[model samples]
Target: MTEHVDVIVVGAGISGIGTGYHLQARCPDRTYMILEGRAAMGGTWDLFRYPGIRSDSDMHTLGFAFHPWTAAKSIADGPSIRAYVEETAREYGIDRKIRYGHHVKSAAWSTEDARWTVEATGPDGPVTLTCNFLSMCAGYYNYAKAYSPEFDGADSFAGRIVHPQFWPEDLDYSGKRVVVIGSGATAVTLVPTMAQTAAHVTMLQRSPTYIVARPGEDRVANWLRGKLPSKAAYGITRWKNVLMGMFFYRLARKKPAKVKERMIGMVRDHLGPDYDVATHFTPRYNPWDQRVCLVPDGDLFAAINAGNASIVTDTIARITPDGIRLDSGKDLPADVIVTATGLELQLMSGVAFSLDGQPIELAGRLQYKGMMFDGVPNLSSTFGYTNASWTLKADLTAIYMCRLLNTMTKRGLRQATPYNDDPTMKSESFLDFTSGYVQRAAASLPTQGERKPWKLNQNYALDVLALKFGSIDDAMRFSNPGRSKDGRSTDAGTLQTA
Candidate 1:
């Protein structure tokens, strides 16, 4: 007999592990297994080994709600974040439920059976499993590939070129000139950290990006932790951060000029008035149009002030044998060129999805509640907030899924599908952000409807009300009770569609 479970969660990352914990606590009767493609547990944290790799968002929010982050540093490093995730899994015994090296190839949903036939490739070979529900926790990036743009003379460059996604273990850059290409988070992080031991570092960007400086440690959170319990302090700090983030986001959206001025002014304060802040730090777009890069304790600014690192605002003409030639007739010499280019965005973990042997094109479908797809049954994908800590939204999603499962069990329903009946509903891109990665993958992602339930608020407070307290029956249609693969009812009566 083939293996079967009540729920199958793909990817054992933060989302998967958190989902596992919620399932154990809220739905104890349901059997679930996590299938991880990688050998390790930590998804992004484990894969990214670049220097100074850390969470851009605060740990109090990035960390799971069930597990309080007791560390002093609000902004945590990659290794520490990975360890925190591993510890959370062990504490909840979610690790034991995980099957490593199990790469889910595809999932086929059967309406008659009211279950998903999940196919994966394990170490032993092909493995098939049946599940009542499928949860896609796999992250939004292409793990196998990073977005590496082609430079005209990249092949002629004699120096070692590296992408942050696949950082080589033994590669050394001590006392060597390094040139990091990009103005995004990865480039900002690499420039400062690499400047510590490097002879000189230059951050070459096609255009400037908004960069912010913040303290690595949270004073309020640390003080609260000392006075109150771990969980209590964490909760307070989490709300504090969430509200503050929301306020700033709203302010930015409402008054883009004011927010942009304040952000640029802060950068000017860090670098002296003598510095060319206009050319090096100013971005043409409004605040929050793209993600603003955060540097802990103003390390990137300090590096530049110390003469160890410099920022060049110019387009890359081509890659030279020993350096990069700029379009503005300037040459940046370097022994190592680090391509801190963005990630290749992926949806549904790149898994081929089908409904009753009919191919499911995610782009054509509409997103329901930011998790489930319109007309898709018994499936949910955990996609975190782009503006705030990913886990803040992810934690809520897990809780909502549990509520959904419990409701189905109570109603004697085996399938819950969100169907869009509004013919006039206008469709928009899944995400409104104009980030390079998001824009690149816009066509491949699902669309969101203009109105409620189908539209994404992206605000945690609003999402909490909608996902947690809102009616699950709003747009969802439930059917199929105790039905077999051949459509024969195994129960006393057929379930009426609701």
Candidate 2:
């Protein structure tokens, strides 16, 4: 027998857990279940187990708003983050609502019935489930595979190669020379951590990225925790971090040159006056052009100063038997190589979606409010901010989703579809980021509108004002295929034909 529910939430990650909580809190009458493809609760945190795996964003804002981040350190490791997520799940009884090893294969929305029929491979094999609304918190990247570009002679490398995404538990790198490719967050993180034990570590990059060092522990938060109550301290710290982040991002955009100089100066201070700051630290683009890389407490620089780690900016020619050969006529000898390149951006976990057996081409659809798609009924996806803490927007998304669901209940509406009829409205690529992961999949991802409501706002303040209390009915057509509890029939509106 097929199971029926008011809502079906895919993925049990941070966003998914928050989604479930908001559903239960705001719409107590609604029944919802979280279908997680993995057996674990923490999605990215659980998947990445490499050395120095930690949050690039501070925990103050990265943490859920509803929960208090009590840890002393604002920058937390993978295991600590995983434990925190599990704590939230257990506290809210969200763990029990999750169905592990349930991979959603496809979903079909029926216009006549105003319901979604979902097909998935559950732990017990093929299972069918029906729901009035589908919440996609599955994230945008593929968890099973990470992006690793092929080198000319990668197959000939005798040394061990590992991607931080699938780091092996039994693997040993102690006293070994390590080479990490890609200068993004993963490489910066791995370099210092591996340098502590590894004989030497090299961060190989095609181009430079802006890197800044920050204290792992927030002295203000610690001071507040001692002076104020737990909740009050957390709230203050969260707001402080949020406001600071907003200011920094705005300043970077308004005066990229000044911000760039300041950031470079900070890096120079970390690496000292004699260090080759221009060679390894200076980036071609302005600060905040791509996501800034954060190094906790100057550990990466300290590692470099201690002569355990080094940075090489050059193109790769091919892989030699022992190590990597660079286009700069230099070869790096190594015992292990880490491809901290990037992640394969996957939309909806590669699940197919159709409306009445007709395939839904995401690229053709309009991204409404950065959450819902134009002409898609009773369905929403959780996409967070690119500039600030991911959960800051994610938490707001949950609250807004709950608001939408509750509105549907009150108005006796079985469906809420974003309808765009303006011919003059312009469409653009989904993300404004120049990051490799985003640029690589920019063409395949969904398109956002050029104006408000449709445009995906990266500013947390604007998003808070818009999504938290914005009109849910505006630009959205609500209807009831079946008779509502209040004896109302479906409303009228025709979807714009492509």
Candidate 3:
């Protein structure tokens, strides 16, 4: 027998937890369950167990609005972050609603019934659950696949290879020559931290990434917290970082040259004048074009300067028993290899779904206000900012979703969908990116358009006003209950349609 509920939330990450919390808070009597694929509650934080894994943004902005992060350090490591998420769920009674080990395989929307039929796989057996609403919070990154570049002799390597996502706890790298691939956030983060213990750590990359150095702690906020109330201090810090992020983003987009020069200056300041800045720190593209990697206190550069770490920028020819062979004919020997070669993001985590018995191609659908999809009613995905803090956008999304739900309940509606009649519309990406992961799966996911709701503006300033203060009527199409699923229904709330 299939169980029925008011809503079904996929994944138990911050997004899923936040959504479930909001839904329950708005409609206390409504029943909802969270289906998490993993065994634990913390999603990304739990998955990545690498050394020095932490937030690029400060905790003040990265943390939830309702929950103020009281950590002394602004930049929190993975363990602290995981603890915070678990704490939030526990405090809000969200942990009780989560069904761990339950992975959603497919969902089918019935137009006749105006409900979604979801099938999931669990440890016990396959369970079927029917719900009036299906909210996807699976996140963008693919949990299973880690990008390990195919080297000609990768099979011949004698040493153990590890990805940050799947690093074993028992593995040791002390006094060993380790080479880390890629220069993104993960690689940059691992290099310095590993150099501390590892005898020698070589950070190899095909091209340089734009690096920004910021103090690990928010000085002003730290001082204010000591002098004023924690709430006021946190609020002030959150907006300060938000506005600073916005200014820099606009500067990068509008005045690219000036921002580039300033970034170069930062690199020069961190790594003395004698070091070659162009080869390692300077990126080919503009800052924020690809997400910039952040280093607290320039630790990565400091490690290189101290001769504990080295930077290699040659193409990989193959892997050997000893180490990696570069395309430039230079062989870098290592005892252990760390493949930090980016992430493979599978939007919605390959969960199959169809709307009204018709296959819903996410790319072909119009995005309603960059959060909700057109032609798909009563649902929205919480996609965070690629360039900014994830929780900043997520907090706004949760608030907006709650507002929409409350509005519907007040107006006596049951369902809502986005309506679009533009025939010339085409699929586009939400981010201005050229990453391998996004380009590879462009055909399967939701595509952004050239304008307005279709264009995903990653600006927090605009998103704040749009999501927090914008009128729901401007984007959402509201309707009253004229016909019920059983052909006999009464008006309880307003239902919006696509």
Candidate 4:
């Protein structure tokens, strides 16, 4: 017999855990299950194991609002992050609801039954489950593969080569020359931390990324947390961070020149006069075009100043047995190589979905409120903001979803999805910006529509104001239109024809 639940959350990351927690708390009578792809939880944290892999944002804001992160350090490492995820799940008792090793292969929506049939592979064999709703909390990036460009003679390199995503546990790099490829967040992060113990660290990048320095500790929040109650302190802290992030984002978009100058000035102040800040730190695009790498306490620059690290901006021709041959005819010798190359982001890992026996090509469909796929009845996904704390957005998504579910149950609504006449709505893309990974997988993902719910805006305050406090009718479409007369439309919000 196939099991049935009110909701089936895919992926046990922060997003999934958050959603499960909210669902359990709000609707204890409603049955829900979480399907995790891996054997354990902590999606990104468990996967990234390189040295000094930590949160780019402050832990105070990065962690959940319902559950406070009590880590001593403001910036936490990967293990700490993983522990936090696990702890949150355990503390909320959501961990017990997880069915580990159950990877959802496909899901088909039955319009007649108004339920989703989820097909998954588990330890025993193929299993099918029915759920009233299907929610994806899998995140944007694909965990299986990291992007490592094939340089000539990559395999010919004598040293042990490792990607930050799948870093070797036993491989030691003590007192050894290390070459960290790419100037993105991961490379920048690896450079300083690896320099602490390695013989020398070189951050090699073809193009530069915008790097900015921010204090790890939220000074105002720390003071407030000490002075006020925990809940009040967290509320104040969250709003403070949210407003700041929104203000800066708006400044960058509106007054780009001033923001650009300030960003450049910050880099110059940290790197000093002699350093070629323009060549390395200056980005070709606008400040939020790509994610701005956050340097806490000026640690990355400090390592560079200490003569332990060097930033090299040059094209790599190929790898040699002894070293990497640059296009400038310079050779950077390394005992170990770390490719912090970006991620390979695939939406839902190419998971197939069918609605009423028609295959759904997400790229052609619209995205509703940047959370749920249009035409994907009774489904939603948790994709956090590229800027600000991810948890802030995740928390909002959880709340909104729970509210929607509660409203549905009250009204006797069976299903809900974005109702759009134009299938080719040009405004479905959540992210308007372009990057290597995002662009490559664009065709495989859902399209962005031109209007409000279909178009994704990353503004934290705007989204929170809309998603949390706003009316549901503006963005959501609810229905129990075709149910029999005997079937009660118990919920008032559930749309019914006169």
Candidate 1 lDDT, 1-498, residue by residue in tens: 889999999989999999999999999999999999999999999999999999899999999988999999999999999999999999999999999999999999887688999999999999999999999999999999999999999998888999999999998999999999999989988898999999999999888999999999999999999999999999999999999999999999999999999999999999999999999999999999888889999999999999999999899999999899988888899899999989999986899989888988888589989999987889999999988989988888898999999999998888888888779999998788888999888889899988888889999999999888888788887776465678675433433332
Quickly count the clashes in candidate 2: 0
Q: Is candidate 1 or candidate 4 better by lDDT?
A: 1
Cα-based lDDT for every prediction: 0.92, 0.89, 0.83, 0.83
In terms of TM-score, how similar is model 3 to the real structure? 0.94
Task: Report the lDDT tens digits of candidate 2 across residue range 18-44.
Answer: 888898888899999999999898988
lDDT of 4 by residue, 1-498 (tens): 999998999989888898898898887778999999899999888888888898988777788888876545677788999999998898889999999999889999877678899999998989899999888888888788888888899888899889998888898998999999988889888999999999999999998888988777677777877899877887787777777778888889898888988899888998898899889888888888877888888899999999999999999999999779999999999999988888988777557889879998787567777778765778887888887778878888888888778877787787777666654556645666666777777776776678776677777777877788866766456877454578742323355221
Best by TM-score: 1
Off by over 4 Å in 2: 482-498
Candidate 4 at 262: error in angstroms? 1.4
TM-score, per-candidate, Cα-based: 0.97, 0.97, 0.94, 0.94
What is the lDDT, from 0 to 100, of the residue 414 in candidate 2?
75
Of candidate 3, the 10-residue stretch with the lowest lDDT total is 489-498
lDDT value, candidate 1, whole model = 0.92
Candidate 2: which pairs clash?
none
> Candidate 3's residue-wise lDDT over 1-498, tens digit each?
779997888989988888877877767867899999999987898899999999888889888777788888888899999999999999999999999999889888775566789899999999899987788888888898976667788778998888898989998999899999888999999999999999999999999888888888878988989998889888988999999888888889999999999998888898889888888778888888888888988889889889999999878988999999898999999999999987877767777879767877777566777778887767778888987898777767777777777776787665666666567767566766766566676676676777765677788888878877877775456655345667864434444332
Weakest ten-residue segment in model 4 by summed lDDT: 489-498
Pick by lDDT: 2 or 3, better one: 2
Task: Give the RMSD in angstroms, all C-alphas superposed, for model 3.
Answer: 2.5
